[model samples]
Target chain A: MPLGLNSPQIVLLGVNHNTAPVEVRERLSLSGSNTPALRLFAELPSCEEVVFLSTCNRVEVLVSTNRLDEIRESITKLWLDRGKMDSNTLQGALYEYHGTSAIRHLFRVASSLDSMVVGEPQILGQLKDAYRMASEAKTAGLVLNRLLHKAFSVAKRIRTETRIASHAVSISYAAVELAKKIFGDLTGKNGMLIGAGEMAELAAQHLIAGGADKLVVANRTLSRAVELSRSLGGSAISLEEVGDALVDADIVISSTGAPGIILSKDQVKRIMRPRRHRLLFFIDIAVPRDIDPKVNDIDNVYLYDIDDLKGVIEFNKAEREKEASKADRMVEAEVIKFMAWMESLNVVPVIQHLQEKAEAVRQKEILRSHKVIESLNDEQQKAMDVLTRSIVQKILHDPIVYIKKGAQKKNSEMILDAACSLFGIDGLEDTQKLQDKCLSDANQDKTIRKPSPN
Target chain B: MHKFLFQITVFIYFVSTVGFLVHIITLRKDAERIATVVLSVGFGFHTAAVLMRWFVGGHPPLVNLHDSLSFLAWAMVGSFLLFQWRCKLKSLGAFVIPFAMIIMTASSFQSKEILPLPPVLKSIWLPIHAIICLFADAVFALAFCIAIMYLLQERQIKKKRLGAVFQRLPSLETLDAMNERCLTVGFPLLTLGIVTGSIWAEKAWGSYWSWDPKETWSLITWFIYAALFHQRLTVGWRGRKAAIMTIIGFAVLVFTFLGVSLLLSGAHSYATWLK
Candidate 1:
């Protein structure tokens, strides 16, 4: 693809969960502390700036370079060597986006629209970590710096303006959300997990992560309960002890394989006095439902079977999908704005250089006539300064407007090159110098103005 | 002048009520903050109005229905501000400020003319009795709002239909704890108010035990709260039971404050003096 002479071409190449299986992702994933990989990407001859992001779901290399083909070949070779995979095997798994599409992809990723679960928040943190790593490795320069920061703000805007991440989308998370609604903060609240079912264990884990004070594992088999308790950093109790545990436990996840209800409304009612009628939440994920549905009848006691949790997850997932479309539109608008800024980066330096060249000529003429001007009064000298400055501004105004307007169109580089050659401005070297200066100035402004990341 | 200040205070409270209602719908922190600031300013104006009434009337402003209702609204705002400071329950104001606004609006419609102090109300016990009782009423009013919130939140959780109110209301435990706090504070005040009322009654009426309609209703209100307070401490009667009892207790307290005077005639009938 033909590109502007000074525009930094952004290219993104990656394999995410949708593109590759876990096995391939695992092989290609870089550890958080992988500064070496970032350094290698930055040191590539064709890569002007680089940021390497490797999460559990994706391994993406974002580079700003003119020689895209060379960088793509080198990045592919390095990825293949690291993953021990052949080109043909990885060919179908790899995906690439160039220029504006690359930027849109980055923005979508930061906003979590490209997440495996669509609205999960971990990707933004992972992206931030990658950006931080690149900064520390001196791999991300002017272009990547601005791009990543823009991505962060775009993510924040989407989060605040859209409800994409506001709902629980998984069964275990839904259970925890309901518990929070009932009990508010989970701090100091005790949880009891009955049976060793995978779903029950996962719910227990979520409760503990939500700040539940303690966990008690109860199972028909004492050894299994002990092993699960050991892994979960909680105590173990036999199935017979589950009744006694009810008084102390505030949240209970019961998933026993029993044919009959293990916890009944009458049994919970009997324990209510001892429990002080504190809120009780029971998540019964068993096929037949380990806790009787009638237990929900007890005041301050809430029961949700697997189907109920699935209902919540489905409702929330639908809500999130609705919000995700809104977020996608917001991301699209932000991408356009950012791409405009990127396009301006190409023309901004040329405009500045044109102004500088005219000022230089004007100043040289003024100095050449300095002896003649010494006879003039101070007011006349001030007038001479203003006169020469405005003359230079008027002479360069149309060309500057033409270049900026051209930057907004597809044939911007042609207009920019024509303007440069007509003005006798060196097309390549001076543009590079001025672009570097402009980028540094922008970087300084960003450092001063950036809000502290939340 | 004091009446004008009171009107301005009511207007400011109305504005704050709107602010809080908007805050509830938008869930904006800045809206809450602005509403709280507006409410505080109104509270200041309210304080000045009450003090001006006290100064101009040459007595504590708790004699007639208008004065007592104004005092009641003032005390409610005071209690709410205190709880808001301590608990930071953001949506509590959304429930509470509107109630205060209604009380102030009701007070506005009542006769604001200051009457000559009644001989029966002319004693040290008048201020002590009326102030303590009305302050207790204010605290119970707060508990009433919290109970409503608790019920709404509990219903949302029980029905498994978490809605906007569920998200805004605090946890069941927090509301219950606040209820218990109000009970602990308001119960003692009620007891003291009754004690002072009887002592004032003995001094003024030549007898301490009269089954006057207001006095009898006050006793009944006391009994309900005492029972709830007793059960809460001893048998741990709380959550739904406590919330329901609080609502019932507040209802009876309101009746003792207003219903007896308007609906029934007795020595405690301040409505007779209004005419």
Candidate 2:
């Protein structure tokens, strides 16, 4: 259904990793609390409700307003002013969606379909935080409160219904996944870290999280090893002790800056006997590789350099994309449902006003004929009251049905206007207020009821 | 009646084998459960058939090639069921059930006639020697399947392919542990089987160390396993090496159990008994 002039419309404006380069996003990114941004948006003359969402990858403003163009222009100006950037530099970087598409975009963002790394979970949490900030600032009124909650539930639904977020898509996580495949469970397994690189440290942390019992950090600089080990709850050893440590370590991640191979096939082979040929996994994430490629040929020794981990990430990325298409369809279906809810909001006020007017007229006429009622018996007066109420309800039933049915059609605004004018109810302002109350009541009911997609 | 039950057992094994294969392809939990349940039912029928044969023939049903093959299938299923009860290795049946089905089918093809027990076979050591040896063979069969899975999974990790087979198979460490467990249990039983067979042979044929084809091959198989067991204990020959050795040992064991009887003329040959 097309929105009328007076009906509130949703508008989303943002610059994401896809639409802007890192430099541009960095300039536009709102890093901390979004309270100031929420207040600024709420103070826009035409904007009724707002939720400001900002993250490392995206900065977005979701707003409900009567005048979409005015709100869009003002928000864009305010965003550019906040980022201290001129309009010409960000002209091509900005993107906007309106009405139903805006709802769809919010859903996609909430579900991480719009993330730089699609299906990453942090965006949903960031969105929730932004929404909470807006709510605390009293900037997120009925429309935004309902919209953000719907977005969260949609994200939850997609997460459960599809395998979009189940696979590991990062280097360290891929290492953990492969480790699990080779070792089944990493519980009580020894892990050896042979470098102080960030990626290597992260991989070691993931191994520890995956239940590896102990970690040994061996680096050329004993001080760096000690520093890293202190944070990881692991022991630090000199580089000379790596050979001895290899015998005890079940999983080894080597990212040393050595120009040549640090662990060779012969060394691994000699240690295999001492290791009782237990399965040994090596993740060599360093450039110019720290472990020999032929080390994998040694029985029970598995070595994966950076390229292999990337290959795994690529495979998992493809798998996630396949699941993402399924999630997209779910989001599309939900957007339609929310749009229908918005459409029903249009007719709710008119229907309420028509019924209220009929009841008021009935009560006024009853009061006007009080003398005749006083002349009648109490039982007759009771029948007179029931008869008048039933007549009013019967009279309004067909019109209410007509208005609800019309709301689902393309000419809903026209039908609504005709119903309002014919009833002599100049109720546009009253309609807005009534719709807000109705939506708030619906929101309360939503919290108390089971969360169904419908 | 026993012949009919054996036929039913074979049919049920074929069905369960299909179920397990489907489970491997689809990776459906219900398929695995149904396959396990159906295999248990088939094992029940197989046990009944073997017991019925023992009662009717007045022997332990270890006389001819037909009875031996059927009994081997029964032993394999029993051991597999025992393992299934203890472990969570559900995909194992995909590799194992087909082997049992093939043996059952082979047993069905052989003559089902119940011959009178030969005088040489009429001894108290018959059941003990045959049952222990067949049970050891069953355990070795389990190791063989587990070894194959280990190689497949190890190949995926080393090659870094990580395909569908990689996803379905258990971890290399778990498979190797299962392989080691099989060896630990199967080796002692094999040693005891050989000892008991030697005793029975001396009592029956007046010789314990015959150069018969079956006896010689069994000795060779025993030596291979003994070496593997020794190295595994002392030097830690595990994972790929252990997996390969388990496979090789099973091959030799199979030849001693089957090829010696079918191809080579020996005291243990069913051909001699049939004559």
Cα-lDDT of candidate 1: 0.85
Off by over 4 Å in 1: A1-4, A11-47, A52-61, A65-101, A129-139, A156-166, A319-340, A351-454
- The interface RMSD value for candidate 1 stands at 1.4
DockQ leader: 2
Worst 10 residues of 2 chain B by lDDT: B266-275
Per-residue accuracy of model 1 over B1-275 as CA lDDT, tens digit each: 99999999999999999999999998878899999999999999999999999999998888878888899999999999988998887599999999999999999999899888977678888888889999999999999999999888888878877656667888888888899999999999999989988998999999997999888999999999999999988878888889999999999988888788888998887555521
iRMSD per prediction, in order = 1.4, 1.0
Q: Give the clashing pairs for model 1.
A: none
Q: What are the DockQ scores of the candidates, in order?
A: 0.42, 0.66
lDDT of 2: 0.85
> How far out, in Å, is residue A318 in model 2?
3.7
